[model samples]
Target: MTAPHVESDQVRTLFSRAMSEMYRAEVPQYGTLVELVDDTNRETLQRHNELRASLERSGDLDRLGVERHGAIRLGSAEELFNSRRVFAVMGMYPVGYYDLSVANVPVHATAFRPIADEALRRNPFRVFTSLLRLELIEDEALRSEAARILAARRIFTPRALELVGIFETEGGLTRQQAEEFVHEALETFRWHGDAKVSLDVYQKLHDAHRLIADVVSFKGPHINHLTPRTLDIDAVQAAMPKRGVTPKAVIEGPPRRNCAILLRQTSFKALDEPIIFTQANAGTHTARFGEIEQRGVALTPKGRALYDKLLGSVRRHVGAEGIGPNAGDYGAELAERFKAFPDDWAELRAQGLAFFRYSATPAGIEASKRRALPSTVDGLIAGGFLHADPIVYEDFLPVSAAGIFQSNLGTDEQQNYTGRSNRAAFEAALGAEVHDEFAMYAQAEQTSLEQALVRLGSPHVARKAIA
Candidate 1:
């Protein structure tokens, strides 16, 4: 006799719920942030009928409430390797290699998330995991010391690793095993007040880089921040102060737009929590914070190139001024430069600037039954037989991520490190190749369009021709 195995989606949902509860308990301010976001989302939905209709049509409305992303920093290759296995049991795979060393953070990252449309619609929980690049540390001695400290510590529970092995040997975990696995896995990300290093060593690492100190000093890589999705991030940003949470100076990612693109994020300041060193020294650490995000349509490569160019212009203007709270006029410059990008959904699609999921309308299905459907996608859409909705962007922005890291790390100095994008090293650490996020989004759009076309026969030409 065999026990029934739990679906990976169910396990992920369970883990996401448990993680939220644990985080809310650990950081009470996060609970308040969540409340503000929930309120804002409801208000946004009530105010925008078109937006609500679009969400319902696209099947995104239900997932919006449960969607969230979390970030964690691992200290070594082995920790990352094992963490990858754990996430796999929940059907999450590493996607998109992001090198944050460009921001002088000394860590490169990948987002572990569900890639399948059904799985994503089920939970859409993401963990933005980063591996510390110790070699980037300028001081040879400190780098070696940091490595030694990381090597000695275990970031995962023994039972979690055992469960992972079991899942790999078998196909999946039984309900009981999965329930236990969620508890054990949660332990790996749980916050610890006790430091693994001495106060003096921590300060030395902190002097080298605040991020280095954070990764090497902690017992485990506690989740730095958990982000809840919001329909209107600017509204949440405005509402933060009223709720007693001070937000970072400017939102990261694109400036506010009528039809939002990519990801827009804002976070309250990181909390200063009490920590006791191994040598009985008492101090405080600022690592965990609350973040809110508004995810919009995934851009096409051409669209992304334009986005990068416009953002580059903004950063060029920001030269030496910094992107922190006091980075004067950064927001104004970003908005002014982004005017080159299209803000209308129809224009974005026609210009091949965004990815969209195409579906057959009820009218289209009825027309197909009578063999009255148009042969071209544009014809069908123009005749109100097919509907196209933007596919959600489910990845992180590198500069936006670094900006959030910098603001929460509470630093005035924008440290510049002498290193470049090392995708090989990041992939080697994880023991797997990272997925191309753009490819993933493209495939999703293509698949949806194909399925809809199948319902009403293939189209000879599509306006965007994702098929």
Candidate 2:
């Protein structure tokens, strides 16, 4: 008899649940963050009945509770190449390249996530994985030393590699093998409070860049932070203090909007955990933290360019440091500058600035069975026969990402490595090209529109055939 097998979706759901449990135990504050976000999401849904109905119609309501995104920093190309294979076993493929060099952080990244709508609705778990850029280090000797240390470490367990190879060879894993894979894979992201290098080496790397020290000193890329989705980030940001969690001074990404766009993020400070260095040296490191995210509609390329321009205009006045003293009014300036961008969904869709999933309403289905319905999407909507919901952005924002990293890594002043986006180099290191996020969003919208039209029975085509 054939062995019983579990699908990748089941494996991913199991892994994500296990990962959350481990992180909650390791960082107690994260559990608190989860509770706060859950409460906030509940209240937001309760207060906005329309929003609740929209979420339900689009199959997002069930996902809201299980959605999560985590981050990890790796030290070498070898690590990244293998990490991709490991994630593939969990039904995750990388989408989008994020270069943090512009923000002066010495790393480039991607988000490993499931692309299919059904897979996402099951559990939208993703990992924002970054690889360190040793070339960005000005100190030649320190860079070499960091590289040598990173080469000497194996981030993944022996069994995890074996299982990945097995899955690749057979194209699936048996139930027992799948369970083993999840257990072994979870080890790679587990916290290790011991440093592989000496305190002296760590200090030199830290002096060069806090993030550099973080990537090079650890045995493995521990999941630094796990973010839970929130309906109202502002509510969580305010309530964090009351719950003894200190939020970042400002939230990352666009200001609060009537219809949220792209991604908005905020996190509490990193925890200062003591580490045992080589030969019994005792010191501290701050890397792991709790984060909350609010993801809105994915945008078109035109929408993104406008967002980038407005954000650039505001960030230009702030200090080069992650959070500048001049940035006291950063939030105010951001809101003011973004006024040029429209806030309403109809205007956004009309202007071709955002992506939405179109679907036939119950009335539309009933009317279609009786007689031909309006052929155009606009007409269908006008007649209350169709509806659209903004398809949530499923990727990261590079600037918001860098800001999140710097905020938690305890870096204040950072050099601006402007005009240094090297997607070619990053892709070469990862062994595959990242997916174009805008194209993905556009395709999703078009597919939904076509499917909705099919459900309406293509009235224009039908009338022509009748004549």
Candidate 3:
């Protein structure tokens, strides 16, 4: 007898339910984490009038809600684009660009970055999508073979397609229809059918499929990870190991010197599971629990500068060359100019110079450094760095993401020497184009500030600030 066919709506419902269930089952300590955040928020409100007032002014935690991060994978651009439509129906949008392909430790793949906190607060769900690079496959025969196999498979069911169509045609479903669709779509993804095979082989295939099905199975698109942010990432990191949850690394973000900024993250290593697969000879086999990897990346000033510079270059180059510039001429000129620079173009752009240059520090540089460190989150707030008002976190750290993925996977394999694909190839596969995460975060923050001003019956106050 064939297994029951699940609808897209059911798949969505089950996906959410299964994710919650899985978290509860695998890392029971996550329950503690959730409770801690709630307790901390409550205690903070009760103990500190200032904090309570600030939260009230900015929008209460109830309004912001609990932040969560999640992970998922897709098989192709079509799936990625279609999934974007589905997420839009639920009120989420693509925010940041992340390149994970260069992450060489263990988990190596490209993905999109974080969503703004406001967007997240409005709806905190964010998924990092990845696609395999067929261009990276050196062996043309293997690449072709894999591509053929992937083309024949269908990751999204008919129901998923229908649901996406509905969401696209109609911004969203009615309350009842929305609930039903969410339920089914979540379920379809979460349901694991019975397929007899060995544990070891099954794991290999699963890992391979994660990489293969993405690119091989329809031009490569898959949700790589779903991530949630917490103010206490450091606390979470410390607690995980104690609870038998082996994290790939410690929290990665700004230094622990007490500052509120873009992001910090850590994750438990991926868990191994047994599975069944068909052999080449039409024989059945089992796969054992294989390795899973994870890793983390912090955005140092240098790193952030690099990131910004790259973005600026892309924008400037795009504007100068136009959308459909001759690839050969454009690449050649850009390469030549880039090579002429001593530092990275992005870094140069960030430093307010076309070349490396730094003025000597004043005589009081040491005394300035010795000033009392900022003790509270509020103390660290500054108009320049922290913004006049609190800004929502946006953007993903690719290094951090690669850290998470690598910590859970097997050893990273060297790419074929004969073929190498760069960041552009990976971005193309994602389908839903990536944007600057920090910019998105800033926009959300500005929106909230305006909203707060309106709520306070002082629209002019916000207008003056903007002016």
Model 3, 1-467: lDDT tens digits are 42333333333333445555555554454555455445444544577675455445444355333444566555445556566666655555665555555443212233332244433334344455554555455557656665555566556557756866776675555555666566555543442323333334334444543444223322123223334444445555555556555654334333332323345565554434322333422322111111111111223344457544543364355322212344224434444444423343233323322211111122222322554223321222221111132333334666555545544443344333222335454456545455654344334544654553333333344231121
Regions of candidate 3 where Cα sits further than 4 Å from its true position: 1-19, 22-56, 63-65, 105-119, 191-228, 279-303, 306-387, 412-432, 442-467
Which digits, one per residue and each the tens of the lDDT, describe model 2 over residues 251-340? 999999999999999999899999999989999999999999999998888888899998999989764324777788888888899999
Clash totals in order:
0, 0, 78
Poorest 10 consecutive residues by lDDT, candidate 2 = 458-467
lDDT of each: 0.89, 0.89, 0.42
Using lDDT as the yardstick, the better of models 2 and 3 is 2
lDDT of 1 at 173: 98
TM-score of 2: 0.97
Candidate 1 residue-wise lDDT, 124-193, digit = tens: 9999999888878879999899989998999888999999999999989999999999999999889999
- Candidate 1 ranges beyond 4 A from true positions: 320-326, 459-463
Q: Residue 16 deviation, candidate 2, in Å?
A: 0.7
